[model samples]
Target: MKIFGYQLGGEKRSGSIENPTVPVSAENFMQFFGVQSGNLPSVTIDSALRVPAIAAAVSFLSGSLANLPLHAFKPKGDGSERIKGGIQKLLNEAPNPEWTSFGWRKYFWQQVFTGGRGVSWIERNGATTAAIWPMDPSTTVVKRVNGRRIYVFDGKSEYPASDVIDVPFLLKKDQISVYSPIMLGSKAISLALAMGDYAGGFFAGGGVPPLALSGPLPAGADAIKRAQSDIRRSIDSAKSNDEAIFPIPPGYKLEAVGFDPQKGQMTEARRFQIEEAGRIYSLPPVFLQDYTHGVKANVEQQDLHLVKHVISQWAKALEEELNLKVFGPRSNGRYAEHNLDALMRGDFKTRMDALSRAVNSALRTPNEARNLENLPAMPNGDTLYIQGATVPLGSQPLLQAPPTGKENDKGNENGDGNDSEA
Candidate 1:
């Protein structure tokens, strides 16, 4: 978002964040997320994430999903209640001793977004889940063997599909490997990275383009070297003395060589790359902190856009995967769900207003609303309430006058409390 002060680092190291200068294969791209260099840099996940747009998109998505409140639920009567214990703790708290739920899930989704696949093993002690362990998508391979899927980790251990939780950004026809975002969006990402490389080197050289020395140049090779040496010495001397002006040889001049950033349309090109990266994840530009085309309505549409077209789809992908693997085929209607209230924690006033309306309309009990705000329940707050003045759709009006039929006066005279006075 803050483009002017982008903290682009030193030039990319060559022959190693470089590649060993070896050619990498398309098939092995997912295995190692390898990079191949050429006319355009081969986009590996590492290089792709270096682009600010890709980094922002990946971080936003994974971090948002990681913070969601995941809980296991079981059907109770007409609906389902969040069930607590090992499974819930495993999902919402600590998956393994080494990692918290948030940490694991963030890593999981990061892989899903970048490498195009996320995988974990659901460790079990007999029939009960013991702990969950994440696998590196770069090192783990999924393949179908004997008409069943298996996860092979580091080419050694193999896990049955029934015991693995897997989500792919997109599944290939073979269902063994996924189409990596970096590889699939290579053209755009490669351009973004190339721009970064050029920008880094350009700005590092004092934001000045290469200088071309001209005029009265000697034709002989030895003479040209002498002139170049003299020019270098003069420039170095001027710089050392902090002088603003340096003299050139008689009839010589210096001018910047090649196209400047503006001439290259760097700003527009960079902005377009951000939009391109957003498209890879189907994310709205607003979500990527791109406000060039943003307005009030466009910004507000993000919540719906994210939930409907982005977050919910990935969340459902994960939910289905986790459920299928963790609970087996006959899950008995017990499922793990993500509570999306975490996404609406944008600001205090909006959240409070929503909760207030929910409570006043009897959509949620006062205590339930309080629980969302981490507030203690008040006395009798668990009960649902509605406006007392409301009536059934076809019911008689309150405090209505009696009918004017002849029997009405006779009936009232016998039964009404004011009969004697009348």
Candidate 2:
């Protein structure tokens, strides 16, 4: 079962010891796994990026958040924001000298997905955040002293917790930093990719049929070996040709060795691997292109589920980290929020219906609705309008009429007079 030098179902061996005097090349390590040396053995960020499912999941999450409007808000009595300006420019335009707002968010989310922790170095000027820069999570280390966490960058420069903004995926007991998903799920991901390689190799060899020899035995061991070699050469030549046909010797017959890919469930196995990788990142099967259990009717619900369960959690983590590091602990009322309206938007008719309800109920102004739709506002768009016929609760109806018989008396008199004249 061994593909590379590494045994498939056997005791594992460490690739290299920590603090080794001699440097080991990546190619040498990769060769230990029966796979080609060109493919690296270790599941580092670079290696994981090669896996399409992992790349897609990371891109979807980071890109989605990066594109969203991240606003800075001051808390109000009604649990709303007063839309402040202090951190607004920093978040919306550029968070640092090097990266735009979108670039910053994308980099942060990429780190979070790959390492389970996103670290950023904050540059502040007298209680105001001037700029920010993302730090390499792989090289950064967290150390605690005097019961306070300290971040050591590249084993050289040291920074206080307040100076660095850290968003962690999942924290372990007594640990200030988060665990890396890539490091934890490396084996599973590597195995899945290895299986993919194996499948590709199987097909690339032209589905060569197995050869069976029967009839009188050759007189000597050399003769039998020669016969077997000839048969293998013939099969190889046939497989290499476009037309997979070959002449068989008098005593040899050939049979197809394996089941069809469908019957053997090879496709299913590959699909399961994709789903499994998606699970490692808490992504939906649909995100990885697995639509076996999906229906068009439920697609929107599935998207909502992804936003609520996956993207929201990451968004909240980033928001809280930014609030704490960028705004400071004393700034209790200020926070960062990602506008998820775009992601949650439904079909045109559904969105219009919802907007209409909001406007009618005074929850939103006409101008606000127009702004959401990116349309020009009218002169009176600021006014909040309710249905004219809508009445207050527990109040008498304004349109109610007097008893029907009494109201019709005047009209009936005119009709009776006209009938007498006729």
Candidate 3:
């Protein structure tokens, strides 16, 4: 099968003398077996493949996935034949019976079925019932960068046992401005690029309308153009200073960012912004709105809230969810065994909870209950009474006596009481 001008079982364009130029355009590339280019061929392929790049991307991805020896090698296990048998079970059990891999029969069997989790099924009515093949672990690798473990081929063993981690997927200048600071490493160039692109995309996607530009931007063309310029600059900056950038893991953000060339410290700023009503704001220096707020896309409230919660949780403590079963518990060849150790020590929730507990404990005192009782009522809430030796409730001092006992003394002094002495 061919896709985007690339042939299946074909060699990738490795800048080898045989194929010096990779498919620069998606349209001109040959479509793979049953892999529809859907107007890809009609799109013009610029020198750098502007429009037809999608085809090239698809081709590249297909080529990469194809490189992994799938099904070509026979399993040596005594249960070797079980691989194919396992796949067949998954196909019969999948809810979408018609679902098929694009003309890649091996993919259907190897990548989808009998891949990672292998195959499991239920029997019903004396017949084999529903079954599914989890993704294969032999081809996947996930591990913690902090640890000396480098999990490869389903996390079987740590590579090198060294802490020097390799950042996946090298960065490109134009691609710099897409993700958040947390998504990018603390490299200034990457962060700037991300901010610029996010800002540009917001304007481009109609997130912020031109009419809403408070200043400088004349809306529409002008706003978009400015965003584009900003993103371009950010990308340029990122490429030059790769080391300074910090990569944000799934849910974390830079906090309390600052740079001291002497100390060799450039870290994420931990400061957060308080949104007052609808206005957008930020903590100075560390981060800011990527683009003009009015020009960006307005995110869905639910999604934004969820993302915010996740990011906040990550920023505060990465340990809690580190071991969460986002994938699963079993060793089916995915990430680490529950990172319970990480979560227990580094989870944002755990840290936040600990902090809260400490603060509450500090606020308590020996006479807190009595103090609260004597506290004055206010329009908003109760006020703490701290000054008096003892707290007393009600309108008057606790030491004061009723008028009945003091009437005799008062009458002699005033000469006007009902018990007055001449």
Candidate 4:
């Protein structure tokens, strides 16, 4: 089968055909030949990360997700409780002696957010998991062989699908090749890099635009060169001395060339790039330190939106992958979950109030809340308690007794008299 398409070689011409196929590598052919020529700079993973907004989005998302507590648990009684040791230790503490859980997960997700995939091998000793080792995706090849997926490291050693944990930013229909974010947003990233370069070169050159020399008496090439040098010196001298005006060569005219930063609306364009970066990652602009549309309520809502829409989705994806690859499809009562509440926590007072409400409303036991807050359990804190007015679903109200018929009588003498008279 052909790697790219049915025709095979991109530069090959069919004997009966007049044209040749072009490969994707030539996508930036124009830029190479034209020397940029006002076209956007080429975009790569490194260049894309150079964009501040893109860098911030990747860092924030990867770190925020990796820092959350991932717990392993099994169904017990009416609910589930966290279990320690084994996979849990590998997930929450250290994946191996060489890497902490946070560090490993951070690197894994860094690849993912950059529109690549992450893969790790689950090292097992007999029936139990022993360690975890990260694999370099760039050198590893993943493909289906005999209807079974496998990982081939550097095209040398092979590992079964059951042992490798794989996560892709996006899966193609074939489930082998994944889409790269750098490629998807190449145009936008290229423009951002170009703008940054333009701004730097513009300011560094002392705001001098292209100038023309006309009506000069100079005859030789050396003389023309000398005249240009003199003009640059005069401009630099004025700028250094903070003068408003600088002298120009006799009978020569200097006109500012190209668009100024103000005319180009550079500020607004930069802000728009930040928004575009955020959009690429499904991240809200506020998280990228852009507050253009961020009012009080919107900023707060954006926080919620981050956890619910972005972080939660990614967390779930990782959790499911771990559960399947680590424990197998028939997990037999064991699974992994991320403590999303960690991200939802607010200020100290608000957090305390929320914990109190959870305990009082019988949503969570006092012991559970205390455990979340990292406090020691109080005596009998495990007992669930609800408001005094709240009762069992089928039980009568405990707050007020049923009104008696004797008290309801219209002509009761004792009811009409004051208690002090008796």
- Choose the strongest candidate by lDDT: 1
Q: Best to worst by lDDT, what's the order?
A: 1, 4, 2, 3
Instruction: Tell me the tens digit of each residue's lDDT in model 3 across 1-422.
Output: 64533455643543221233434345634343223453222211121122122223223333323222222112354422213433232322231244332223223222211121111112222222232223233354544465533435444533331211121122235432122222222232233333344446545743422221122322344454555555445545665675345333222222322223224321121111111101111111111222223222343342244235422332222112211222123413322111112223335676556544443454433233233235444452333323344445585755866577677777767876664334
Report the C-alpha lDDT of model 2 over 1-422, residue by residue, as the tens digit: 53422335543333322223322345455444333555535677778778787788788878887888888888789676646565797888888667898998788888988888988898888887888888998899998999889999999999999999898877888688687777778887786666666677677766432334544542344555666777778867876684457666676555555456667787778778778787788787787787888898677677878888988887888888888888888877888888777764657887898899999999889999998898999898999988878877879756866676653566667674234336
lDDT per residue (tens digit) for residues 55-128 in model 4: 99889999999989999998899888788687889999999999999999999999888858888989999878
Clashes of each: 2, 4, 46, 0
lDDT of 3 at 225: 50
State, as a TM-score between 0 and 1, how close model 2 is to the true structure. 0.76
Indicate whether candidate 1 or candidate 2 has the larger TM-score.
Answer: 1
Off by over 4 Å in 1: 1-38, 238-244, 397-422
What's the distance in Å from true for residue 242, model 4? 3.1
Q: Write the per-residue lDDT of candidate 1 for residues 133-167, one digit (tens) a residue.
A: 99998888777788998889999999998898888
Clashing pairs in 2: 3-34, 4-33, 4-34, 5-34
Ten consecutive residues with minimal summed lDDT in candidate 4? 15-24
